[model samples]
Target: MFDKILIANRGEIACRVIRTCRRLGIRTVAVYSEADADAQHVRQADEAYCIGGPRPQESYLRGEAIIEVARQTGARAIHPGYGFLSENADFADAVEAAGLVFIGPKAASMRKMGSKAGAKELMQAAGVPVVPGYNGTDQSPETLAREAARIGFPLMIKAAHGGGGKGMRVVRVLDEFMASLESCQREAAGAFGRDRVLLERYIGQPRHIEFQVFGDVHGNVIHLNERECSAQRRYQKVIEESPSPFLTPELRAAMGEAAVKAAQAIGYVNAGTVEFIVAPDGAFYFMEINTRLQVEHPVTELVSGLDLVEWQLRVAAGEPLPLRQEQVRQQGHAIEVRVYAEDPDAGFLPGSGRLERLRLPAPSAHVRVDSGVVEGDTVTIFYDPMIAKLIVHDADRPRALARLREALAECEIGGPKSNVEFLERLVRHPAVVGASIDTGYLDRHLDEFMPAAEVDPDLLLAAAVAQLLAQERAARERAAGSGDPHSPWALADGWRLGHAGKRELAFVHRGAPLALVAHGSGGDYRIEHAGHDVVVNGARIEGDALSLRLDGRGRRFRVDSDPHRVMIHDGERRLRLEPVEVYRRQSGGSAGGEDRIRAPMPGRVVLVRARPGDPVRAGDEVLVIEAMKMELSLKAPRDGSIAEVRAAPGDFVEADAVLVTLEA
Candidate 1:
């Protein structure tokens, strides 16, 4: 085994590689960018170095810089942990040229599989099942249009070097073909440095399943089961699971054979994945081959009882195959949910800010959290927003799903918005629970998955009462000097009065206010509101927060809260209460009355579609902003003339930055 290895990536994968390397007694070195100076992965490694700026091109993607770091740290091997330079054939060649082992497939194999078009041709030549599409090298617009027509409408235009949904577009109509083709090419060229694209017939109700394949230098390859990855958004996978719900034993065998064939065709070695699009009729078509460890490898690991990274390192060090295909067996079901720092309500735009509070679910025999961030860590727009991969394994699929749901519910995160609520809803959806999933599942059932109704009066009242009681108890503790001895209440003298003092507490529940009167003293009290009297005991007040026991239920509430707004936690969901003064009118708002265009997210302006005094329509593209490797187009809000173009191409702008103002 290698004595020392350098991880040529950052974030969770880098941290993941470090763990395996340590277990195998291999010292690990980490390289970071300026933005990640105190990143989790950097702190976890034995040695660390700063390569360059925050952007990938200047740091992580700089092969030479990474190689230099490996050399300086005396790392004998370089593990490109997925993304950035992981699939870059040139990077692999450079690592080998520096006399450092590349802990992945051979550079030659990567070169062949890096291009989707080339991979398709190779797969077909190897007698593996491949989708009928145009994989030729013709770049003429006319040829592409012709190919699209031949392939039929509702086709997919994918970048030859695309992954994670970048540089891909799905067109269902002939009229939208040309524009989508051009856009796909532009994005493909910008993202992958390749304008080449391929056309494939869009398979309706398709399920994305990928097989994990591993190989050694001794000409042995084996499959490690399949992962169902159909739960996706924006063409990127969101949730994945092992032992696909739709795959039978017979189908699994066939797919496993095809995965082996696909890997062998490229002389693949180390760890790789063969992705396929399975149709509703049980027919599967080859999608592409990833030439490195996958982001979702944990689910496979959970079921296969093997550390893929360790295997990769061992294989790269000239080790022979340790196990044959017949020896590999899957033990149980494992599901992985990708927790990302994104706003689900805001079209899933990546969120960036300091993680003020973070409470991860405890790991047990069934749960594992692979994370690269901690509380107070800033999630910048410099890289992928994935914060952690939460995986749960159990004896059965239903048990695994239930454990995963519980785990997600226990995950507490604050600061920037995230898709935790959305993920929680998705896993609990009826169709999802029934294992009836496809690419269109989310889009088709969006209305059914809106935030759960807030009209449960009983639950709301219980939450409010719990809050009030907790507050009263905290107040008693403060008065008795039993809590926070430095508190001002501890210094106050208690005076007996003929009549108990009444304090009016107003709280908003489910967008409505409830006025309650606190009666009695300290341990014994009754809260009266809405013609109902609730007995309270053991009430305590600390500062503005409250804790109390009421009617066999434990409730905690915060009062003396923000006068304008208060937040209530009901153990399941958070309720926001705002004073009437701060509430805005929700009805009859003017639509598209101005031409002002705003940047959707913080990013560099990549393209300015219009200039000052330019004529524009209500929905015309005004500019394009690039953030987190995705391009967002800013559009005119109304039909008007462009009065000013405040931002030019290459200028950085923050979220909601005004870019173009329209003249009425």
Candidate 2:
């Protein structure tokens, strides 16, 4: 084994690789960008170095700079952890040229599997089942259009050189083919530096399954079962599990053999995943093979009782296969959910901010958390917004799902919005519980998981009680150092000469102003809001938990608060209450108006399709901004003529920056 290795990626995957390296007595080196100077991975590694600017183009994708870091740190091997440079064949070849071992498949094999078009051709010839599509090398726009017509509507246009759900689109009709093709090509070129695409016949309601395949220097290859990755949103997997509930033993064996064959066809070495799209009839078609470790590899680890990173290290060191295919076992079921710093209600818009309060479940034998951040760390805009990966394991899928729900309840993230509540609902949905969800099910029925915009009367009272108790505690703490600490003046209970006065507070709930009136304090109160009055007693906040009574019923809720908003959680339901000054006036403008288009996150403007005086209809894509490796289309909010275009191609803009405005 190599004495020291350099991790050429950041975030959870980089930190995860370090853990296995530490276990095997290998020193780990971490490389970071300016944004990740004080990142958790940097603190955890034995040594760290700053490569370049925060953007991926300036840092992570600079293969030469990464190679130089490996040389300076005296790292004998470099592990490209899942993203950034992980699947870059040229980078792997360069690392080999520098006399450093690349801890993944050989460059020659990566070359064979780099292009989705080429990989499909290779797989068909190797006797593995591949989807019928256009894999030819004609690069003309006319040729692509002609091929789309022949392939028929409801086809998939995927970036031939891209993976990870970027640069891919599904066209439902021929009328939308050209536009989808252009958008897909642009995303592909931005993400992978390649604009070539391949068309595949769109499989309806297919389950996305993939088998883990490993090969060694001795030309030995083996399979590590499969993972069910059907629960996806926009081609990005949200939930993944091992021992797919939809697969029978016979189908598993057949897919496993096909996966191994696909790997051997390319002389694949080290770790890789052969992805497949499976129909309801047990028939499966080959999806592109991922040439590096998958983001959801923890599910495989939990079921198989093996460290895949450790296997990659040993394989890269020229060791033989750890175990033959028949020796591999799938003991139990495991489920994993990716918790992201995104707002599900806002089209799952990813955000970057400080994690004012991040509380995740503690790791146990049954639970695992792989994250690179802690409570005080900031999730920068320079990379993926994955907060954590929550993995649960048990004797069966039902038991594992129960653990997953319980573990999700233990999570409380404060600063930026998260999908914790959404995930909780997802795990309980009938489609997921019954293991009947397809790849497009989440997107098709998203409203079923999203809570109604209307707030409940009980929730308002709970928020009022929780907020009042929290304020009372702060007041008591302030009075501790005063001369007359016990004086009633320190209290904020609206004390009057003969009767207790109502303490009025202002809050914004569901975008509407809410008036709250509190009648008492000292763990007892009456809350009146929206013509409803309720008596509350025993209201107190301890740390992040709130216990109180509303009307005659006892209530308890989890409280996560920052200066901006207070989030109250009761089971899987959550209500975000923003406290405002009682006398503060409201600010309004067209920045968030129907005639204006604003950037949802901090990103670089990649393309602007609208100019001054251009007529556009509602929902027309007027601008595209690339943020954190995803292209966001800023659409026209209403049918109008474009009055102004402030952002241009290649311009970097902040969150909520006005990109375009239409005539009122």
Best by lDDT: 2
What is candidate 1's lDDT per residue for 20-121, written digit by digit as tens? Answer: 988888998999999999999999999999999988888999999999989888999999999899988998999999999999999899889878898899
Tens digit of per-residue lDDT, candidate 2, span 240-344: 999999999999999999999999999999999999999889899998788999999999999999999999999999999889988999999999998999888
What is the TM-score of each predicted model, taking all chains together? 0.85, 0.90
Error of 1 at 35 (Å): 1.0
TM-score (C-alpha, index-matched) for candidate 2? 0.90
Q: What is the C-alpha RMSD of each candidate to the true structure, in Å?
A: 5.2, 3.4
